[model samples]
Target: MIPQKLEVLEQTEHKLVLVIEGISLEMINALRRIMLTEVPVMAIDEVIILKNDSPLYDEIISHRLGLIPLKTDLDVYKLPQECECGGFGCPLCQVSLTCEVSNATNAPLMIYSRDLKSNDPKINPVDPNIPIVKIDKNDKVIIEAYAILGLAKEHAKWQAVSNVAYRHYPLVEFDESSLKNPELNSLIVKMCPEKLFTMSNNNTLKLKDDYWRYCTLCMSCKNNSEGKITVSPKEDVYIFSIESDGVLEFKALLGQLFKIFNEKIDEFITNLEDLEIES
Candidate 1:
């Protein structure tokens, strides 16, 4: 099969949008599943509570910690199960974080994810505003947590992508000449939920590309226009978007995804070759 062509439309540290052509729907969906469940990320796996004066129990606090997204460095870290240390616990396989808070103020104090101090400066909470728990005056909470690289299949806390999905590229066509009537043009604008259509100075109906991805293909404009407007999807092209959990940059995540895909393909080919030889 010929290699697919990928064109990045927009990219940021946490979000990515791309146009992939010359690929089958099955291949695109497989990549989406891999991004959701196969990509490894660092998250709290173990917690040790030395003291607790808050309302939340030790187990509850530990569970909350596990859900917090932590920035990941794939180059420097290895999954505990795959590590040569036999899953015992090593700097390369696990990261240590400590949270110690003693509320001495007159009012209640809220503990946030930022309060958790990490031994490795590179690995920390993605958002500092996430609230862990609240403690009353003169109350205190002490805890130690261990983070390790893990896959989303084991737990959702390890999921690196939040909104990962793809859809067929939309194709919109409308007859500008038919839209000469001001009332019809106004109706078209009001019918579009995405507001993708606009009136130009030449009294022609124009479509904006900015919100085309948001189109639901409801065909409200087309149906009301007496067949003047048409909406369809491109068969071989897809628009893909992904929002990361900040554990890994979106670009790096895509790189890792392609690497994993290539490895799986190679393994499948090797297995097929062996079976043919046996036959």
Candidate 2:
């Protein structure tokens, strides 16, 4: 058993920063290989439609695994419990959809997604019980609509209530008297990597409240400023709820493993005593 715990922290996207304690370089490499190859580990997140037709899979498997869409009420129905972020239910931060299908001769349906959601009559088989379609008598087609899981914490799915995101570091504001040349706004604009800061028609430097989501908190904006720029996140923010698919929560799994290991160790020690002579 390893001496110290492996701290897994959420990084960006589907990647994680694993800080191993008291492990040698050789052991780290060996552990990494074992985890990747042996463990059925995945970074939990919302389902992303990378491609309607992921070429990586066969048509049948793709239909079953990736084709069918997942819809849930987490986006629509508000939770009775008060959210950590104090905001009433807002549609911009939450939404829901239903995916229903039935009666298909073929396995993978090459249907257009935009067309499915945009029909004027709101499409047929909208009811929860009705099948989107019906195929054969014995093999009834089924519609599977539920909240998607199994994506990285960094994936957009990890948002508080929905897949919405905001800047980790907001703009910092300072007073106008602090700069050598208060008239020039070019320096402030140049400091932003996402080009979020711009000069208003009134000649005062302006930041877009809507575009703040792109800010990555690199500190360039703060470094270039001489004075008088008030950097802060937009006051109103939305929250989303997300759940994991038994992945990315490796710590819990590690705990289970340790419990089993101790049990086995006790059994081994007991067996060894049987071979010893009575003292």
Candidate achieving the largest lDDT: 1
The number of clashing residue pairs in each candidate reads 0, 20
- Tens digits of per-residue lDDT, candidate 1, 83-151, equal 989899998989999999999999999999999999999999999999999999999999999999999
CA lDDT of each prediction against the hidden true structure = 0.89, 0.38
Q: Give the TM-score of candidate 2.
A: 0.29
Give the distance in Å from residue 1's predicted Cα in candidate 2 to where it truly belongs. Answer: 38
Query: What lDDT score goes with residue 139 in model 1?
Result: 98
Candidate 2 structure lDDT: 0.38
**Which parts of model 1 have CA positions greater than 4 angstroms off?**
1-5, 178-184, 200-203, 209-211, 276-279
Tens-place lDDT per residue, model 2, 1-279, is 453554443444323344344545454444433333322221111233322222233344323333233332232223223333333323322222333333245454333333233111221221223222223322322222222322223333322222212122244565533443534567778768889877766556666774544665566667676435545643322111122232333354344335444655798899998886777
